[model samples]
Target: MTRITAVWTARDDLAAMLAALNVDGDQCRYVGGAVRDALLGIEAADIDIATRLHPEEVMARLETAGLRTVPTGLAHGTVTAVLPNGPVEITTLRRDVATDGRHAEVAFTDDWREDAARRDFTINALFADPATLEVTDYFGGLADLDARLVRFIGDAGARILEDHLRILRYFRFHARFGGAADADALAACTTHADRLKALSRERIARELLLLLGSADPLAAAQLMADCGIWRVILPETAPDGLAQLEILLAREGQTGALPEALLRLAALLPTDPLLADTVAARLRLSKTQRLALGRYATPWPTSGTARQIAAEVQPADSVAPWLLLRAPDAMVSEGLKSLEGWQAPQFPLGGRDILALGVHAGPAVAKVLGEIRQRWIAEDFPEADRVRQIASEVAQSAG
Candidate 1:
C-alpha cells in the first residue's frame, strides 16, 4: 500500500486534472520522477502525468475541464497544465516508432506498460494511481527503488541505442540514487561510449553539469574514467580532476559554501584558464557563465590577505569558491570569514584625482596612479584621505 495521496492531494491542480482525465476512465497516473521521488519521501518538484488518452484528446479534455493547457511538445505527446504553484506536464503514452541514438520518433499509444518500457530507468517508469496512491510497477521499479539500484528498463545496450543521451542519464541517476552501479548498465555505457560523440555538445554539457551537481558524482565520475568513457567524451579533464573535486567538495562543506554546479565544475577542472574557455565554448555556455568559469580557472591569490584579495577581484565575491578549491583550510577559513558582511571598499583615488594633483594628463598621471593603486591595495583599500595622501606623495615623487 505504497501511497502518496496525502502528499500530492495538497496540490490544487493534480486533483483537478486527475478528476478531468478520469471522467470516462482511469486514464491518467502520476509518472516518472514525480512518482519515484514521492515514493522515496522526497518532495516531487516536477509533476508529470502519464495518460492513455492521445495528445489532442488530452489537451481537449484539459481545456474543456477549464484547465489551461499548453502544447509543450505536441509531437512528443506532451501538454502542460498551468497551476498556481508551477506547471505540471501531462504526456500521452508513447512508444518509439524509430530512433537514431540522438533522436526518437515516437507514436502515441494507449498502453501504459509500453510507455514504461520505452523509458530509460526502471525507477523512472513507476506510475501511481492519483486517487488510491497505489503504485503500478510493470518493470519491478518498486523493487529497484527499494534496493536503490538504477537499472535500465530493458537491455541496457538496446535502450542506449534508442537514445544515446541515456548513457549520461544512467551515470547521473547512478550517482544520485544507486547503491552500486549496475554492471550491465555500466558496461553498456562503456561500450557505447563512442556514441556519445554523436550527441551535441550542449546535450553532453547539460548531463555532465547535472551529474556533477549530484550528491556524490565522484563515484560515478571515477567509474566513467575507469571505463574509458571520460577519455572518449571529455579528454579535457583527466582522471586527476576527480581528486581536486574531492577536495573541493570537502571544502564546500567546511566553509559553508553552497555546492553550486558551475562552481563545482570549475573545481573539477585543472586550473587552466585557456582550457576552461575551450570547454565553455564547446558547451556553448552563456557569455556570463563562460566568463565566470574562465575567471575561476586561475589559481587563487597566494600572496595577499583575504580583504586584499577580495579588494583586488572587487564587486563580486567570485573568489570564494576558487579560494575553497585551491587554498589550504586555514586560508579558506580566513578568506571566507573575511568575505562575510564584507563589502568591496571603493578604491578612493581614480586617475582623475591623480590628474587634479597636477600629475599631468599623460602617462605620468597613469604612472603615479599605478603607484598609488599598489599602495592602496597593499593597504587594504584605505579611505579617500589616505588615498589622496598616497596620491599626493606619489605625484610629488613622480615630479
Candidate 2:
C-alpha cells in the first residue's frame, strides 16, 4: 500500500492524458521505471504506462481526448502518447503466449496481475494508479526495491531463457542498483551467459556500455569476467583491462569527471588500435565511437598542452588527456586540468601571407606556410607578430 508520486504525474499535460485514459474508470497507471524511480527518489527520463484498455481503444481515447498518439508497437498492444513532458509508451496489459529467447508473442489481457507476472524483474513490475497515486505491487516489488535487490519475477532461469539478453540485463540492473546481487539471478545469468551470443551485437554493445557507464562498474565487471561472460563476448579483453579500468575510474573520481562508456571501454581493452577497430566492428559500434576507441588505445604524445595535442589530433575531445590517462606517462598533470577555456588556436600565417612575404604562389608558397606553422606550434603558439616573423624567415629560407 505504498503511495508513490512525482511531479511528472501532476503535470498539466499528463493530467489531461490520465483523464482521457481513465474516462472509462481506472484503466491506466504509471508503470515501469517512472514508478520504480519515483520511489527511489531518482528522476526518470522515460514514463511508461500499463493500461487495461485494448490498443485500438487506447489510441481512440487519446485521439478523441486531443492527445497525439503513435503506433509504436500496436501488434504488441503498445501505443506511444506524446505529451509536453515526454512521450509515454502506453502498453495494453498482456501475457506472453510464447517466447523464443528473443521475441515474445503476447496475448492482450485485462489482468494487471498477469501483466506484472510477465515482466522480467520484481522491481520493474511496480505500478501506480494515476487516479489515486497508490503503488500496486503485484509481486514483492516494493520490498525488493527498498532492499535494492533485483530479483526475477517468477524463475530466474525461465526469465533468462525467455530473453537471452536478460543474461546481460541482470548484471546491468545489479550494477545500477549497487546492492548485493541476488545469488539465484547471478547463477542463472552465469549458466546462460553463452546465450548472450544469440543477441544482436548492437544490443550487447549497448548493454555493456550502459553497464560501464555506471557510477562504479568495477565489481560487476569482475563478476562478468568470473562468469566467463567476457571471454565469450570479448575475447580480446586485456588481462589488465579491469585493473586499468579501476585506475581510470579512480582518476575520474579524483578529477570529478563523469564516466564515459567509450573511454571506459578503451580502458578495459588492450591498448591496440587494430584490436580496438576489430572489437568495435564486432560490436557494430558507430564510426565515431570506433575512432575514439582507437585514439584512446593509441597513446597521445606524452608531452604537450591539451590544446596543442588537440590541434594536431583534430577532434581533441576524443583524445582528451584524461581518456589517455592509461598511457605510459599520460601527463597526469595535464589530465588534471579542465578543457573549459581550451580552444585549438588558429595558425596566424597562411599561403597568402607567405606569397605576400615574396614567395611565389605555387608549391613553394604552401611549403613555406607549412614550415611557419610547424615553427609556431614548436614555439608554443606565439602571437601573430611572432608567426609573421617566422613566416618571413621561412619564406626567405625557401627562396
Candidate 3:
C-alpha cells in the first residue's frame, strides 16, 4: 500500500479537475480500472471516479471550474468530464433496482459498497483514492487481481440480467487477465447464451474481433464453445478453422508482428467465397476488410480445377499480377532484399515509336505499349531492338 498524495501524482490535471468540483476527497475516489491496472503496474487506459456528489451537483461544479462537461447519461447518473489526460467518466454511486436481462433500472445512492456490488467482476470493482493512494477492497479484488482471476462481483446470473454483454465480456476479460470460470459464472453464461442475439451485430463484431486478436484467444474461444456461446454468435465458422487458428496463434504472438484479425478470421472460416462474404457482411466488416477476407478464404490454388477455371476466366492482366503477387504469404521482404542489386529498365519504345511503325491511334497503340511493358518486366528490359521485336510480334498478332 503506497501512501501517496494528489500533488505527487502523475494525473495532476485530473486531480485539479476533481478539486475544482469542490468534491470532498473523502467522498470521491479514483476507482475501477485505473486502480486495478496501477496495482498490476500496467498502464491504465481510462479513468473513472466514484463520487458522492449527485449528478447535477457534479455537473455544476465542473462548469464552475471552467471544465467542459457532458451529461453522457444523466438518467443513469453518469457524467463525462473531458480532462487533458483523457475523458473521465464520473458516476454517482448507485445500485440496480430492476433489470430486464439487457439493461438495468438503477437508483442513486451514496454507498461505495453497493456501487461496487453492482459491477461486473471483482477485479473490476476495486477502488482507490488516488490522492491518498489508499485502496478499498470490499470484494477482495486485489487478491483476484494478483491471481489474474476474473471473478464476478456478486451473482453472475443477476449481473448477466443487468447487461448480457457481460457474457462475452467475461471471456474477453479472462483472455486479457487469465482466469477460469467459477462454476456460477460458467453456468450463467451458458444459460444466457441466447441473450447474446439481442446485442447489436456491430457490438458483437467489435467484441469478437478483439477476442480473436488476443494472445490466447483460443482459450476464451474454447470456453465459449464449452459454454455453448459460440453457436449463438458465430455458428458459421468451421471447427477446422478454429484448429488452424490455434496453430497460427502458437507461431505468432500478439505483438506488433501479428496478422490482422480479418486475415486470421479468413483462415478460420470456410473456403467458399460466398460463405466468407456472407459472414463478413453479417459482422458488418468494412468494405476493404471484407475484400481482404475474401482473398484469404480463396487463396492462390496452385493446381486445383478451381485454379485452372479461375485462370481461364481472366481479369485484366496488369492488375491481376499486382494483386496476386502481394498475397499474404508473399515473401515480400526477402524479394525486396533480392532486388537490392537489381535495377529497373526504361522502355525503349513509346506511343510515338509505335505510331512511327504505322500503328494507329486506336486500341492497338495501347495494346502495343502493354506488350512492350510485359516484355520489359519478363526480360529485364534488354536492348531496344529486342523489345521492339516483341512489340512488333504482338502488334502483328493483334492485327
Q: How does each model score on TM-score?
A: 0.96, 0.94, 0.79
Go through the candidates in order and give each one's C-alpha lDDT: 0.84, 0.83, 0.73
Candidate 2 global TM-score: 0.94
Judging by lDDT, tell me the better candidate of 2 and 3.
2
Off by over 4 Å in 1: none
Model 3: per-residue Cα lDDT over 278-355, one tens digit each: 988998988876776666566454432222222233331211221222234343233333334433445677889877
Model 1 accuracy (lDDT, Cα): 0.84
Better of 2 and 3 by TM-score: 2
Q: By summed lDDT, which 10 consecutive residues of candidate 1 come out lowest?
A: 313-322
Model 3: CA > 4 A from native = 1-9, 22-25, 254-256, 301-393
Candidate 2 residue 370 Cα shift, in angstroms, is: 3.1
- Which pairs of residues clash in candidate 3, taking residues 3 or more apart in a chain or in different chains? none
lDDT string for model 2 (15-54, tens) is: 8998898887989888888999999888888999999999
